[model samples]
Target: MEFMDHLHSHSGLLRLVPRRPFPVTIAPMQWYRLEFHMANELGTLLPSTFNLSDIHVECSLLDKSPAALSSHWHIDWQLLLQQGAWDSEPSLQIQFLIRPINTSLPPHLPAHLMVMVSPTYDGDNSFYMLPLITAPFCLTSKRQTANNLVPNNRAWSNYVTQHMYRGFSLPCFDQRYFLIRESWVHGTPGKLWDSALVISDALARQLLPLNLTRPLKVLDLSAGTGVIGLLLAFIGQHQNNTMLDITLTDVPEALSLIHDNRCLNKITYPRLSVAPLRWGIDKDIQAIQAKGPFDVIIASDVLYEPIKFQDLVKTLDKLTTPSTQTWIGYKRRGLKLEEEQSFFTLCHPRFQILDRSLDENVIHCFGWLGPHAPTLTTSLPPCLPHRVTGVQIFHLSKNSPQS
Candidate 1:
């Protein structure tokens, strides 16, 4: 029975990795090719036990297009069992080609590719859709080879991403825009984190009434592109009474972009700076403390990986003071419940968790006007909530007196 399970393992799940890194851009009216290798882990152990029935590959542009173009924009390939047993080998190599088309596709759009395989044996039927690739790319005027470009090199370039927030900062301003440079092209700062928006919104509302007259010191841990920190700075500027001195910290690879984003925003009212800090490192902790204890710490989407959970908790322990307020926004990705519980368990010893339930205070704080209102004139457009889900915001503070 165990041997049969081994043979069928390749049928239910496909082990696929991108042959090349993300952001694979290509030109319009030119042929584009993509290559990938499929893992055949069990083929050697039980080659005769199962048979490969079919293989299917698909590529499509996810962005909205004209009805005529959108309907035919996708490319697909299907292969049958008569094509021979391609799965008998230890690994299978596949390539896809996109033929030239007349449509004028815009630049900076993302193309998604998915592959599924079906295998049958001993009168059993099953299919596997193991690997899905989302490569955010654009159609350009000039042709280029997709595989030649390295994903990591683009991370240091001037790739900019923009985010808009409603009813942020001053009540008079209906909306605000933030331009961020993504240091990691594979979608660290490259992607806009929804949790960042929710946490920033909640923080602004909760702190508005406090009205601290003095300059408020703030820190953003794992601050990808410094979105939350930048929002807090904007809030401080609008509050008139509180000045927010902001420090944005992340891995060394991300600091270059964080500094560039701070400059792009033209922020001057509240001093903004960047630091490179690896979580749980003693020297890094001491360097951050040189700026003194922060009044508020903001983090978002930093707890996705389980291995880093302990280090993150230690970093938080080092940064929090008696009066420090910490706000965290997390989106639960399936399969990490243990990591989430473990994080809170470690945090329970030193910090008290504030209730995360969304009430009228949190909702009204959005100040979203009706959909009929002008884009920039409304605090927030009504449609924002529809796009937000599966996210929770937590507020925490030290339970004991500061040493």
Candidate 2:
């Protein structure tokens, strides 16, 4: 079977890496490399195991349209997939137009440049896949040296209804999940995750029934970028059978992202709400608990650190009643077997754990079939362990009231 035919996570993604520092001077000639590399679902580069053809590149100024830099720079497409080896350093030679092309950019101010690569696949209804963009680099003058890369914030992850949400195959409604970029620190709660997508898929297919007696109440804990809650809201709004009332909560810093995404999607009060929730904090737990004993509570990729496990369990205990259905989607990074087991151990006292990770209903990868997908895709970062990643689904509920 095709890997994508049964996948639940993204196969692989493309990334543009700069060879070195970018404060280049307007000398006789300047060389800067905007190299292309394929990354696994974990964002680590993979050796050229997949062939990527018919791909497009956009090298342009960050603040201006790609066309604005056309006269100023000429770039060629030298993608990593073109080179069939892992050791090959495939660099594209970007020609510099010593002179400024656009009058809008003042010569006194160095222009910023970013490279974006998008792939066009071969299929029945093939469309341009998600584009991977590089962090902006400063185009400086001969005398300039210092650098301040622009803060990478907010990007839209477009999802066609049929492509992402099998249940959400609404012809008119598509989803644009707002992400805080994948360049976040490990366990940072602001970026989109494969586990979250897995959870989303599970909710759409297995958990949420195709009929609603009451607005199915949902609580998303540690809701980074609010993907789960937002997705539930979108689904409920579109599919009458699955109408939902969702509350997305996270730490203070991460809450703004949820709010922005909420505003970005034009999702407002009643259908969805945003709140600042810090796990283990008594006041925070009390404030959120008042809202639920929710019908369903979703938490994905939150079992990250051992130090935070107790707190997360505490929060879950506070919000769930005997009837609440809690779903957790977890992907282990470098944690030991016992370390991961510790989480379930902590929950043993308050909840009943049903590990359906091995079940056929679970979607191991995202519902996008990217280049080469499972067969040729690999996790190639030497610093990191060389193993493919997978998400585990844990269905938890309060133990029998008698106990």
Best-fitting candidate, scored by TM-score: 2
lDDT of 1 by residue, 58-160 (tens): 3333231110123324443333223213443433333333333435654343332222222212223332222332333454445344444555757622232
Per-prediction TM-score to the true structure, in the order listed? 0.53, 0.60
Clashes per prediction?
1, 4
What lDDT does candidate 2 reach at residue 294?
A: 95
Candidate 2 minimal-lDDT segment of 10 residues: 159-168
The residue pairs that clash in candidate 2, if any, are 8-365, 8-366, 9-365, 9-366
Which pairs of residues collide in model 1?
108-138
CA lDDT of each prediction against the hidden true structure: 0.52, 0.55
Best by lDDT: 2
Candidate 1 stretches with Cα past 4 Å from truth are 1-171, 174-176, 181-186, 205-211, 237-242, 363-387, 401-403
